[model samples]
Target: MAKVGRIKLGSQGLEVSAQGLGCRDLSGPGKPEPDMIALVRHAIDIGVTFLDTSDFYGHNANEVFLGKALKEDEVREKVELASKFGVSFADGGNKVDIRGDPEYVRAACEASLKRLDVDCIDVYYQHRVDTRVPIEVTIGELKKLVEEGKIKYIGLSEASPSTIRRAHAIHPITAVQVEWSLWSRDVEEEIVPTCRELGIGIVAYCPLGRGFFSSGAKVAERFSENDPRKRLPRFQPENLEQNNTIFERVSEMAKRKGCTSSQLALAWLHHQGSDVCPIPGTTKIENLNQNIGALSVKLSPQELLGLESFVAADSVKGDRSAIGLATWKESDTPQLSSWVAA
Candidate 1:
C-alpha cells in the first residue's frame, strides 16, 4: 500500500499519520507479547507513527508495552504518542474518576511519563468529562503542565462541546476523542462543527464500531466477555440483531467500492471532514495495513450522503452508549445530566 495520509492535530501543527494506530490492542487483548511487539513495530515501519493509547488499557499494560516498543525501536522522536488519564486503576479495571485538580493533573502526567518512559507526553488527554469538576479547572491544570513542558499538547476524550469550550478557554484543547463511525454519527450534529470552528482535531475511537462493522459476527463472538464492547448497548445480542442492517449497508457498499467493510466505514468517516481522525485498534499487522489503506478508498459525493442518510435515527438501532453514558451534552457551556451520577 502507499504511504498513509498525514494531518495536523488540532492547532499545534503536529503532523501524525492520517490513519493512526490504536495501541490499546498490544496488551494481551488476544495476541501474546512477542506477537504484539511485532505488530506494533510493523505498523510503525509502514508509516503509522501516531500511536494512541490510554492509561486504563490492559490495566496499564498499554503504556508499558508501548514504552518497551519505543525504547527497543529507539524511535521516540519518530512517533507521536497520545495517551489519556481520568480513569483510575486503584481497584482494577477502568472506573471513571475526575481528578483534574492541579495536583492530580501533575501527578497523572508524571505517572504517565514514567509508564510511557518518556520525558514529555506528545499529547495528554483527560479520559472523560468529570461532571463533578468544572472543565475550566481541569484544563487550567493542564495548561500549567503545558507551560511546565510536562506535556506537549492537551486533549479531551468523550467530552461535550460545552465541556470542550470550557476547557479550551483555559487552554487550547487540541483534540476530542470519541467513538465515532458510520454507526455513530451523533457527533456530526454538533461535535464535528464545533471542533472545526475551534480548530480542534476530532480523534475517533472505535472507528470500526468496536469491530462490529468490520469483523463478521463470528469474529465478534470471539471477543472475551470482559471486553468493553461486550457490555456496550450495541454489542448486546438483541441490539446487534437489530443493528445488522448497518453492516448489510456496509457489505453492500464494500462490494461496490471493492474494499473491505472496515475500509468502507473508514473512508466514509474521512469524508466527514479533514479535522476528523480515527484510530482503529487491532493486534494484527495485516489488519493495521488494511486500516491505513482506507485513506485510498474513495467515496463519491452521493455515496457519502447516502451513508449519512442511511444512519439516520430511523435506521440506527440501539443506544450508542449505555443509557447512562448516552446522556451527551453537545456545547461549550456547563450541562448536567442524571446519568453522570450513575
Candidate 2:
C-alpha cells in the first residue's frame, strides 16, 4: 500500500487518510457493481482508507454496496467508514424532505448500521440541516449514538458557520463536509474559519469541482440527462463557457507543474491546511490512482498563490447548485431562539 499521510479530525483523535474516497457515485443507476467494488478496494490498497457516502445516495444502495465491498473482516477493519442521513424523497422523488428529529436520527442510524453491516460507523453525518429541527437537537441524538457505540463521531454537511458552532456546543463535530474547491470558495469566508476555531475538520466534497477541473468544461457539456451535474447552474451552457477559463488556467498550471489538473486541484486543497481532507470519487482504477498520486504532488508557496489568484471566487459564475438544493448560506446560522420557542 502507498504511504499516504493521515490527519487528525477535531480533538477526538479521529485520524483519517489525507485523501478519502467519495463513494457516492460508485453505485449510481446502471453502474457496474463489480467495478465499483474493485475501485473502492483499490482505493483502500492505495492508502485511501477514508470512505464517504450517504444513506440517501441511490436511496440506501450506496451503503449496501459498501457493505458488500467491505464484508471481508480484514477489509472492514482497515477502513474508516463515514455515512450520512437526514434527506429523503417524498412523492416518488418529486419532493425532497429533510428530517433531523431525534426519532428519525435514531432510526436512520439503525438502518444505516444494518445496511452497512457494521457494529458502528466511524463517522455519521447529517447529510443536510433540517431547518425545522434545531441543530442542537440533531447533535444531541448523535451524541447518544456515540455513547451507545453506534457511531464513533458526528459530522455536519453544508452547515453554516453559526449552525456549526451551535452543533459543536452540543457535541464535538468531527468533520464538516462541504463543497470546497478551486471553484467553490464560499465556505472559506466563514465555515472554514469556524471549523478551525472549533477544532472541527473539513471533508471537502467535490474538491475536483465535479469533473470541471479534471476533465475540462468542454467534456462537462456532455453530462447525460440523469446526471445530477446537469441540474447545477455552474454546468449550464453559458456558465460552463465562462468556467472554461478556470479550467484553462488550471490545465496550464498543471502542465507547468508536470501533474494532471486533477492532481493539481487535489494538491491545492491539501495545501489549504492539514485539517482538510478531499474525498474525490471515481469509478475507474486509473482515476483513483491519479487522485492518490496527488499526495506526492507538493505545490510551493508561489505555485499555490498562482493557482489561488487564477481561480479566485469571482472568476467562476453560477450558483454551486440549483436553487432548491440546500446551501450553506440558507441553512447556516439558524436562530436558536426560534427552535427554543418551538
For lDDT, the strongest prediction is 2
Q: Write the per-residue lDDT of candidate 1 for residues 297-333, one digit (tens) a residue.
A: 8888998888776677777667777655523463232
Displacement of residue 147 (Cα, Å) in model 1 is 1.2
- Over 1-342, each residue of candidate 2 has an lDDT whose tens digit, in order, gives 466778897778899999999998889677899888888888888788999988999888999999999997579989899999999878998777998889999999999999999999999999999988889888888999999999999999989888988999998999999999998998998999999999999999999989888888876757887888888888888788878888898999999889999999999999999999999988898988888888889898999889999877788889888878887787753455666524
Q: lDDT (0-100) at residue 75 of candidate 2? A: 96
- For TM-score, the strongest prediction is 2
Residue 58 miss distance in model 2 (angstroms): 0.2
TM-score of each: 0.92, 0.96
Q: Which 10 residues in a row give candidate 2 its minimum summed lDDT?
A: 333-342
Instruction: Give me the overall lDDT of model 1.
Output: 0.79
Candidate 1: pairs in clash: 161-331, 162-331, 162-332, 162-333
TM-score of 1: 0.92
* Clash count list over all predictions: 4, 0
lDDT of each: 0.79, 0.89
